[model samples]
Target: MLCQDSAFRLYLDRCRRHKFGLTEAQLPDGTHNEQDARDWICAACSIESRAELDHNLEAWQTFRAIRNRFNRWRARGGA
Candidate 1:
């Protein structure tokens, strides 16, 4: 179970309406921030069928881990 926040729900709807993917750039709605995007994608991912959710979860986790690691590195000293 994940946090069912308003932002998450909004993104879920966005995903349902459009083709949601791992967007590298800032989403037009300003979902570029890591946590914000995660909230959006996670919600989006969870809204699909169980099979789809299961498949997408791994990819989402990988993406999030990589992004978080990068974020940490930047916080430390990385460019």
Candidate 2:
């Protein structure tokens, strides 16, 4: 299930402060394309894009940790 609107709103707000603010790109309709959707949501939530990230970087390897940080921040009302 998707996140609730209230939770999403809070996450969106937090994203504005924390994420790269990437814009959503519209794809063809009915495409089971989850990446675009995921990117859209992450953009909305201000979460960093892991798509083009170079996981070779030491900091990049900490991707999950970054996600956890955002999740924790969301739980804490990251405003």
Candidate 3:
């Protein structure tokens, strides 16, 4: 699943740190953990869960768009 992918998880961490400007101390529990990333992904994609990306075409497309944007940012050395 997308949520279980190591690379994607790392990207999420970077996104929170760089793109979102969120530090661990700034998070609710002083941690930018897996659940936080999953929550962010769900919120960003307007889906209830990461599993939805597998069966929901719209959610998958939205996730892809997000990933593409993140990749572009990374390519430009934004992370």
Candidate 4:
């Protein structure tokens, strides 16, 4: 239920905004929704589902790496 977690969802949104340099409202295609973040997470973690992050060590590690990078990006004032 990681994707369902409010804080995590917010984190995803923030990360996306930072990476894309655009807010959800500013996106030309009208995408950048929660599902898009979920899909991005799944693809980055190499998992078919977000739930696998809870049980799959490799996916969890990959997710941690992504989070760490996001944290650094935030620390550096990205976006």
Candidate 5:
């Protein structure tokens, strides 16, 4: 996933702020194409219920944690 992408980053920020409205389950699955990243942002922008917001936050948290770890590893030359 392109976490650095503006749209994707916005989605992540929205999720962090506890906003969510996506109907489809678009949680990260270790691999994401550009379309998947765009879909995630679209979902964030369309969130319409408390349940979906909560789900988004949960998924985003997990995704962020994993991404952070990967970034740290890469920084340490794990790439």
Candidate 6:
């Protein structure tokens, strides 16, 4: 999973390089989310998804993998 994070971070880094950077966007629900940011991150880079910008599956998978790794590492150290 760490390998995946490294890969994704590298991807997102490329995204960051492509986009000026991820920026917050207001959703239809009227809450600010990373939708626009992720959209820019992908549309300007790799792995486009048809999911709602905020709920984009590609982003979710990347986030989930990173979070899971963090949680597992935290558990090991009683953090």
Name the best candidate (by TM-score): 4
Which tens-of-lDDT digit does each residue in 1-79 have in candidate 3? 5555555566676656666677755642324456766887899889997889889998889889988876776687654
Q: Write the per-residue lDDT of candidate 2 for residues 1-79, one digit (tens) a residue.
A: 1223344444544454445554433322233235544555455444565443444354344544555655787688653
What does candidate 4 score on TM? 0.60
What does the lDDT come to for candidate 1?
0.47
- lDDT string for model 4 (19-77, tens) is 87986676433244567668888998999988898899999999999777766765776
Candidate ordering by TM-score (highest first): 4, 3, 5, 6, 1, 2
- Go through the candidates in order and give the C-alpha RMSD of each one to the true structure: 9.5, 9.3, 4.2, 4.6, 12.2, 11.6
- Residues forming the 10-long window of minimal summed lDDT in candidate 3: 24-33
Q: Is 4 or 6 the stronger prediction by lDDT?
A: 4
Return whichever of 2 and 6 wins on lDDT: 2
Root-mean-square deviation of candidate 5: 12.2
Clashing pairs in 4: none
Model 4 worst lDDT run, 10 consecutive residues? 24-33
Residue pairs clashing in model 1 are none
Instruction: Rate residue 29 of model 3 by lDDT.
Output: 34
- TM-scores for every candidate against the unseen true structure: 0.31, 0.28, 0.59, 0.60, 0.34, 0.32
Kindly indicate the candidate among 5 and 6 with the higher lDDT. 5
Clashes of each: 0, 1, 0, 0, 2, 0
Clash pairs, model 5 backbone: 21-47, 21-48
Off by over 4 Å in 4: 1-31
Predicted candidate 5 versus true structure: per-residue lDDT over 1-79, tens digit per residue: 3544544444444343444554324443234455655565445446443245356876566556656755665576544
